[model samples]
Structure formats: C-alpha cells, structure tokens
Target: MKGGNMGNMMKQMQKMQKKMMAAQEELHEMSFESSAGGGMVTVVANGKKEITDVQIKEDVVDPDDVEMLQDLILTATNDVIKQIDDKTNETMGQFTQGMNMPGMF
Candidate 1:
C-alpha cells in the first residue's frame, strides 16, 4: 500500500509484460506438425493455430472412399492445433497462476 511498494509492483508488472510479449512472438514463429493414418496424412500449423500446410500420401488417397481421406485430414489438423494450444498454454502459464490462460486476452 505504500507508494514505494506500488512503484516496485509496477516495475515488476512491466517486466512480466515484456517477457510475455517475447514468449508470444517466439510461439508465433514456431511450427507444429502432426500426422494421422500411419503417416498417410500430415498437417502443419503455427503457434497461432493457423494451418500452414497439409500433405497426403498418394496411396492413402482413395477416390471411392473420400470420407476416409477426409477423416484422416481432419484428425491431423485437429491434433496439430491441439499441440499449438497446449504449448501456448504452457508458456503463458509460467507468468500466471492459471488465471491468465492462453487466448483469454
């Protein structure tokens, strides 16, 4: 409650903010990959949960069973997204007591 204590608290908050920004930027620059169907389908995503790429093995592509192929792609995409989300939550949790969760702000 003292003035000096408040000033020090502000400085600490500023430092935490800077570190969080740096972590967010690093996360954004990183890449994540996941596959499904025994490597028949692969999906790549960035830390911001944006899909960067999707690859499918020719052998897995079945014209008659389009639904199966779709399932594989969906599985890969969802897995990669989960990876990004998990990493983000972990990195941000370092500065928070679980109150400032990822994507909340």
Candidate 2:
C-alpha cells in the first residue's frame, strides 16, 4: 500500500511540474519595461531575464559629459533587471507556495 501511494504521489508531482513548465514558457513571451533618469533611458526585458531593448533619448547625451549618459544607461539596465527578478518571483510564487520542494525552482 505504501508503494502504491508513493506511485500516485509521484504522478501528481509530475503533473505539477508540467504545469509549472508551461507557465514558465508562457512567461518567456511576456515583456516588462523599466526606465530611469526620468525616462531618458528605458529598457525592455523578457521573463527569461534577457534584455531585449535599450532606448536612450538623444537629449540626454551631452558631448562634454559622456559619463552622465553612461550612468543613465547603467541605471536603466539595473532597474530593468530588478523588475524582471521581481516579476519572475511573483509569477513563480503561485506554484511554489505550500510546496517545500528544495531546489525545485
């Protein structure tokens, strides 16, 4: 009886794993955008935490202050990465709750 119960539990776990994979795949197609320096720089990233785009306003660039432009870009990129991390956690939390499966995520 114990063996039979274990088999059933394994099957249920497999089903949940499949569901989580599907959700992750769907998330890969979703995009999140973040900006910094008053929107002078903007970044777009996918759920996979891959950066897809970076946009810089021309007015933000000054010939004498290239470092300022670089700083803005860096800030925007970091902000986008943070947004991606937050979003991934929130999305995956739905499946992780109540399951203490170590290393599952």
Candidate 3:
C-alpha cells in the first residue's frame, strides 16, 4: 500500500479504537441481571463480570435446604456473568470481525 493509503488506514483504525473504547465504557456502566430457581434467587453483574448485587426471596431461604439455596445463588450468579460475557462479545465482536490481528487486545 502507498504511504498515504497506509496513513489513512492507521487513522481509521485509531478512530475505530476510540469508538470501541467508548463502547466498552458504556458497557461497564451497564448492568446485567439473572434469576434462578424460578426467581427465588437473582444476581446482578456489571459488564466486567463483577458481581454488583444479589437478591434472595424470603421464601426461598430455608435452614433445612441451605444446599438448595446455595445452588440457586450459584446458578443465578453464573447466569448473570454469562449475560455480561455474551453482551461483551456481541458488542466488541463488531469491531473485531474479519480482522486477523492478534495480540491487539
């Protein structure tokens, strides 16, 4: 490629990088929620896969069934994290599609 064309491509890549960063910031500000055990347990996670909140229905808590409760919580947490992962892939995949560059991230 000519020097001018290469420069233009670099500029475009930089612009896209900026946009991707902004989109990532937006994602970080967003939250994902998921529930398990028929809404008995719910968990919220940020785009970075950090748990933000957890909620358990009062009726779901049972001293005799602590294991069940734990399972529900785990399921909900995993689901919420998966949601964030999926959204991140969907959002960032747009910028990465058809690009063979490795180690750029």
Candidate 4:
C-alpha cells in the first residue's frame, strides 16, 4: 500500500514540476518597464531579470553633472528589477502554496 502511495506522489510531483517549468518559461517572454526622474530615464527588463533596453531624454543629459544621470539610470534599473521580482513571486508562489518550503521560490 505504501509503495503504491509513493508512486502516486511521485507522479503528482512530476506534474507540478512541469507546471512550474512552463510558468518560468512564460516569464522569460514577459517584459516589465520602469522609469525614473519624472520619466527622463526609462528601463525595460524581461522576466529573465535582464535589462532589455534603456532610454534617456536628451534634456536630462548634463555633462557637468553626470552623477545625477547615473543616479536616475540606477533608480530606473532597480525599479524594473523589483517589478520582475514581485511578479515572479506572485506567479511562482502558486506552485509552492501550502508547501512549507522556505526560499523555494
């Protein structure tokens, strides 16, 4: 009886793993956008947590104060990353729901 139960459990686990992999693959095609400095700097990141592109307004460029521009870019990138992280947790949380696996997601 225990052996049969274990086989069933393994099958269930395999199904769950497939679902999780599908979800992750979907995330790879998703994109998140964020802007900083009143939209002067914009960043687009994909679900892979990679920054796809960045756009900087010409008016925001200041050769005398490069630090400010750098700050804006940094802020935009951080925001995009945060967005990806939040979405990943929300999507992947479903699989781990009710499972006491800390840091699994």
Q: What is the lDDT of residue 29 in candidate 1?
A: 95
Clashing pairs in 2: none
TM-score of each: 0.91, 0.85, 0.92, 0.93
Candidate 3 structure, TM-score to reference: 0.92
lDDT (tens digit, per residue) of candidate 1 on 1-105: 999999999999999999999999999999999999999999998888889898999999889999999999999998998888899878977878656455563
Q: Over the stretch 1-105, how does candidate 2's per-residue lDDT look in tens digits?
A: 699999999999899889888888988888988887899999898988889999989999899999998898888888878877777778788889997978755
lDDT of 4 by residue, 1-105 (tens): 699999999999999999999999999899999999999999999999999999999999999999999999999999999999999999999999898998797
lDDT tens readout by residue for model 3, 1-105: 899999999999899989999999999999899999999999988888889889999999999999999999999998888888888889988899898978533
Most TM-score-accurate candidate? 4
Weakest lDDT window of 10 consecutive positions for candidate 1: 96-105
Supply the TM-score for candidate 4.
0.93
TM-score for predicted model 2 compared with the true structure: 0.85
Model 2 lDDT, full chain set: 0.85
Q: Which stretches of candidate 1 lie over 4 Å from their true place?
A: 98-105
lDDT ranking from best candidate downward: 4, 1, 3, 2
Best-to-worst order by TM-score is 4, 3, 1, 2
Where does candidate 1 clash, by residue pair? none
